[model samples]
Target: MTKREIDEVSGVETTGHEWDGIKELNNPMPRWWLWTFYATIVWAAGYTIAYPAWPMISSATSGVLGFSSRGDLKAEMTAAETAKQDYAQTIAAKSADEILADDQLREFATAAGAAAFKVNCIQCHGSGAEGSAGFPNLNDDDWLWGGSADAIYHTIAHGIRFEGDPDTRYSEMPAFGDMLSKDEIRQVSSYVASLTGNSTDEQAAAAGKQVFADNCASCHGDDGTGDREFGAPNLADAIWLYGSSEAEIARQVRTPRHGMMPAWSARLGDTTVKELAVYVHSLGGGE
Candidate 1:
């Protein structure tokens, strides 16, 4: 039957004689939709020929234009490298001290170093370099190693307190657990606290003074002031490595705490390391 007549007719076709008032229409596919489907097939064939659309055993087919995602990425990387070359040249030519002197260059280095710190150093040093219980605060002037440009650079290039590193800085604070009794530890901690003028029990502080004279006088001096050459922290100052809590101090005296700050020179490059040191030094604690 003609298309229009087929649409108007009721019960045009049925599988068998219907028992209820339900029947199926004798439908044909829409001609417009059929034409569009044919068009899609043709378009797909054209697209397959012009683009890398087909898969092979080992790789995909190359398109007529020879376009590649890898090639695009390579071009982008090359452009980025070219842009960075000028900055890199400036960094290489300038000395760390010179960079520190130039406000503009120092600013650039600061920005660059900040980015590097976020990725590499911030985890241990903290975002502000204030440090945690074990870690040393970069914002403070107290450096176990040295804070000079060369010293900072060297430290970054070669890590300290790390295993398997031949040149790694090595020093172990002897654990007093086996040597000193609990009362002695508490006394020593109180003495250490008194040196810094922190609140402490007078009796405990007095007892700790004798322990300090016997055990800690050589490195820490008679007054509990530190010897920088030995990397001993000054007990006279308010700065505490682990913390100032009485409990924290007592624990340290009993067990000792050794924290390691990673070196960044090799990983961040000399210029970046210098910039980071300068930035850290300027953070209200540079001596």
Candidate 2:
């Protein structure tokens, strides 16, 4: 057996573990630290007994306290829902315009609607409400139906061209391919593009002016500016719901794609629909 070594320099006992003439000191922990360590062990044992610590086959062992984080969360959620009941009821009773007129209610509805929009509308409108190829950008001033808070509410509540809702905003552009020759469609497309200074062919645009005046002037106006009552989009605007390219415009002229929006009132109810309208109107484009 190897005897433990003592360092002569400081009279401290060595652990007899030596390498390269370096000896380890055999020092006991301080009394306070030892007591603290013992206390922690006792505390840990108590904690395991009082809290959920054991694993089982299908579930975990319930502690003596019978406390669960999920249960607590459920209780908290119920409390939060209860607290919002009054606001929800108030929103249900009031009109969208009335809700927007009130600053406090508007603020609340906007916040709530923003949350709802993230969950429901984000998939189609994008996270920032910047629309894609076919979707209408909500941040811009261009509106097919209208941009007013009331108008937006009506559109969102009832939807656009939604067959399920009898009151949905409905409009259908005639497929010019069936009515006009291919050259005429091209000429009209160029003219429509020329309304926004996007046309390349001046002669074609000139020829299309008469065609537009004859067929499209009633709904789209003489100057190519849209009539909102008919949900006709302005041909003069830079914002294009589908695309602005000459080919794209020609395609739309040949065969128009009518987009459909589901009536949210049937699914989300009137209060939430109003809230959504208020929120959408506040996106900096509302009239």
Please give the TM-score that candidate 2 achieves against the real structure: 0.82
- Per-model TM against the reference: 0.65, 0.82
* lDDT (0 to 1) per candidate: 0.74, 0.90
- Candidate 2: how many backbone clashes? 0
Q: Per-residue CA lDDT of candidate 2, range 201-284, in tens?
A: 999999999989998999999998899889999989899988998899999989999988899988998888888988998999
Predicted candidate 1 versus true structure: per-residue lDDT over 167-224, tens digit per residue: 6665667888899988888888888887767746999989888998998888878987
RMSD of each: 6.6, 3.6
Candidate 2: which stretches are off by over 4 Å? 1-5, 15-23, 38-75
